[model samples]
Target: MFTNIRKFSAVVVTSGAALALLSACGGTDSASMGGHDMSTMSSSAPAATAASAQPSATFNDADVMFAQMMIPHHQQAVEMAELADTRASDKEIKDLAAKIKAAQDPEIQTMQGWLTAWGKPMPSGGTDHGMGHDMLGMMSEEDMKKLADAKGAAFDKQFAQLMIAHHNGAIEMARTEQSQGSNPEAKDLAKTIEAAQQAEVEQMRKILKRL
Candidate 1:
């Protein structure tokens, strides 16, 4: 699934957009929170406007963490996909890899843009993925090297298995964001990631079965 970008400002802006979008959809029964009438709250807008507050402009700590962690996670996936171009022999595997790369590369940029717009520093420094091996289904450097060195049927099989595992990790993280996140855009993105990765996971399993 393709993701839409939002101008997700910090916490304050997110709250405002929630208010505006809700109001736009139809008035709320109680336009207030914690004794404050959000309808009359009259707070100044964040640095961004509603037009810009897309893909994500309002976010909470959960959204921030989701973006921060997922950035590197998606990056690693892109790296693995790049390797598939040469290493994979099966046409379906190659096409899937290409699709994964196309989908995730822009998502990396979108998340990074959210972090930057929110005034958070993107994880600094090199090719280091900065995620645990089991924490988010990341493969070790050794494993990546192994995949890179492989070709033909061996490469396709290993890639499908590893990518399935990797997609599962991403789906897990995305589910967390959906439940715990405040930014509408971020939550929607999480849903997109979850659905897309789940579909791909099943696809990969079918490919593996054939191999």
Candidate 2:
């Protein structure tokens, strides 16, 4: 009788264990069937957080200064180009001014975008950082007045001379940016400006000689 009792107890324990396992399996299946999607839960995670974990590009103070100063300097060039188009009598001079205006205006927009993205303010006119008075071939008030008042061959000659000086200044600024700027985009722009303005300088010199 005791042996039979022990056998019955073992059978009961095995049955209980099997029921527990069966309940666990049923719960898992219910979770799956009840639209509890583990895969979708993982897929819905924010990717921006993962992206934000990556390193950002670095820039130095010189890079900031270059962008700040050049924006205004390019603005001045565009102004001068507009003036030349209005006042210049020579077709070549007018065409050149128009081209300069076209090129620099887009570049100004690009630089402005950079400043905005970098959280820097647009350059103001009042501050003087000793970047020299001749930033990007800008003429003094007197020189601009002279250009405005001159006419015919005189205007053409003066425009060429002024433009050459202006292009040279742009090249100098671009070189500085190339040497000191840490931002890759700024450095690339500087290189482009250097190449383009250098070419313009040569063309202006030829125009001056012809005049």
Candidate 3:
């Protein structure tokens, strides 16, 4: 009878261990299911983000050229605007100069950021990235020098004339970007430039008539 009791105890212990092992395996399987679901969600999120980012990330040669060419164009305009602080005779001209400087300065930084992102070089030196005379409405060295020499009323008139041409050139370049560039942000910037500069050109023309 004691031998039978010992055998029964051994059987009970074995059955209990088997139940515990089974329970552990079930818990592990449940945890694995939850983990797989989370992993799937995490993986899909990046794919969605990449898809959304694709348009802005993609750019073409025109977009590159637009930014490259415009940075110097804007720099020159800002220089011209700076001259108005001391050189311009009219309050209108001074106000306009301030406006131009404010608008174009941020634009310059923004384009620089783009070039950096694209691994493209900034236009070297004071010139328009070798576009030179071919770059429409860019002031000649002589033209800038002459403007610098002038003071008061003469400076205001010259500033208006030169800036009208400058604005026209920027508008053309912006239109080109709109038509040919692939990047959404660049094209949008181009459009903003075109609209804003066109309005400024009109305002300058009116100012010219008054002068």
Question: Which candidate achieves the best lDDT against the true structure?
Answer: 1
Question: Using TM-score as the measure, which candidate wins?
Answer: 1
Candidate 2: regions farther than 4 A off:
1-57, 125-131
Which of the two candidates, 1 or 3, achieves a greater TM-score against the reference? 1
lDDT, candidate 2, residue 68?
Answer: 60
Q: 1-211, model 3: which lDDT tens digit per residue?
A: 1123223224323433554565567633211111111000000011111222123567765676676667667777888899999999999999988888887877777777787887767655454222242344567666788888999999999999988877877877677677767788777777778777877888899999999
Q: Write the per-residue lDDT of candidate 1 for residues 1-211, one digit (tens) a residue.
A: 1111112113324554564566567754313222111110000111112212235555666677677667666777888899999889999999999888887776777777778788876753332322255555766667887898999999999999888888887887777777767778777777788778888888899999999
* Model 1: worst 10 consecutive residues (lDDT sum): 36-45
TM-score for predicted model 3 compared with the true structure = 0.72
Please provide TM-scores, in order, for all candidate models, with all chains considered together.
0.73, 0.67, 0.72
Off by over 4 Å in 3: 1-55, 128-131
Q: Rate residue 161 of model 2 by lDDT.
A: 84
Q: After superposition, how far is residue 179 of candidate 2 from its true place, in Å?
A: 1.3
On lDDT, the stronger of 2 and 3 is: 3
